[model samples]
Target: MSALLQLSKLIDALSERIGRWASWLVLAAVLISAINAVVRKAFNVSSNAYLEIQWYLFAAMFLLAAGYTMLRQEHVKIDVILHRFTKRTQIKIEIFGIVAFLFPLVLVVIDLSWPLVVKAWLTGEMSSNAGGLIRWPVYAMLPIGFALLGLQGISELIKRVAFLKGLIDDPTEKKLAKTAEEELAEAIRAAAEGAKK
Candidate 1:
């Protein structure tokens, strides 16, 4: 159990770093989009590469941050009703969800996508659109993202189980502080959480 917890901490650290890194991609995507638009309109020049790269960044941002999101417990959930349950019950439900849904889903996605990524890389596949970037980098994101997600899922499962065993604090409890960006995300989440009420 201690060993597993240590592994969980390591995974959590990695997820934290990756999440922070992924945050920069959001700015990068925005900047690229703005620049691409200006270049296309002002310079009367356009390339499929520019357009595809924007979506590629968006994809990378989403894919790479999944484990980080999971580590932060920032992923969506039925918080309103969940808050009503006892902590142990909630942890049990979380364990069940991780075991039954998260792990299998991650495995399936990686299994299906790995072949495509390998094929794309090996074949040196390029985008059909003129001047578009190679496809493998984007294709590779699927397995890499899901693998990270699976690792975080393992860490979360360990933490939840340990919590249930009275070995740790509640894994679902809110953190004490939030970054400015996280506060804004929370505001948006709070509004979207109208569904929860």
Candidate 2:
């Protein structure tokens, strides 16, 4: 169990690093887009490559950060009814969901996409658009992303089981601070209330 916990920590670190790296793609995409727009409007010199690269970066960001999102417990959850249950029950349901749904879904996506990635790489597939980029790298993201997600899933399963076994604290508890949007919303509500008073 301790060995498995150590392995989970390693996986968690991998997901964290990859996710942080992937997050920079957002800034890169935005910069590219702004530059592309300026070049098109000012110089009337733009290529489909710029547009395609932005698209590719955005796709990569979403795909690569999936595991990171899962690790952070930020993925969408249908907790309206589930929240009524005890913590243990909630954790048990989560384990069941991860096993029954998450794992199988990841496996299927990787299985279906791996051949396509291989074919694209072998054929040297490029975008049909003039001045666009190669296709295989983006195609490869499916398996890579899902593999990362699967790894994170394994880590999460280990952590959750350890928690249940009284080996550690509750892994389901999110340790993050309030998001920027949440803070902003609170500020707005507070200002409104002050104004009313």
- Candidate 2 regions exceeding 4 Å error are 177-197
The Cα error of candidate 2 at residue 181, in Å, is 10
CA lDDT, every model vs. true structure: 0.89, 0.90
Could you tell me the TM-score of candidate 1?
0.88
* Residue range 78-136, candidate 2, lDDT tens digits: 99999999888888999999999999999999999999999999999999999989999
**Model 1 collision count:** 0
Q: 8-81 in candidate 1: lDDT tens per residue?
A: 99999999888877877877788888998999999999999988999899999899999988877779998788
Q: Which pairs of residues clash in candidate 2, taking residues 3 or more apart in a chain or in different chains? A: none
In angstroms, the error of model 1 at 161 is 0.9
Kindly give the stretch of ten consecutive residues in candidate 2 with the minimal lDDT sum: 179-188
* Deviation from native of the Cα of residue 3 in model 1, angstroms: 1.5
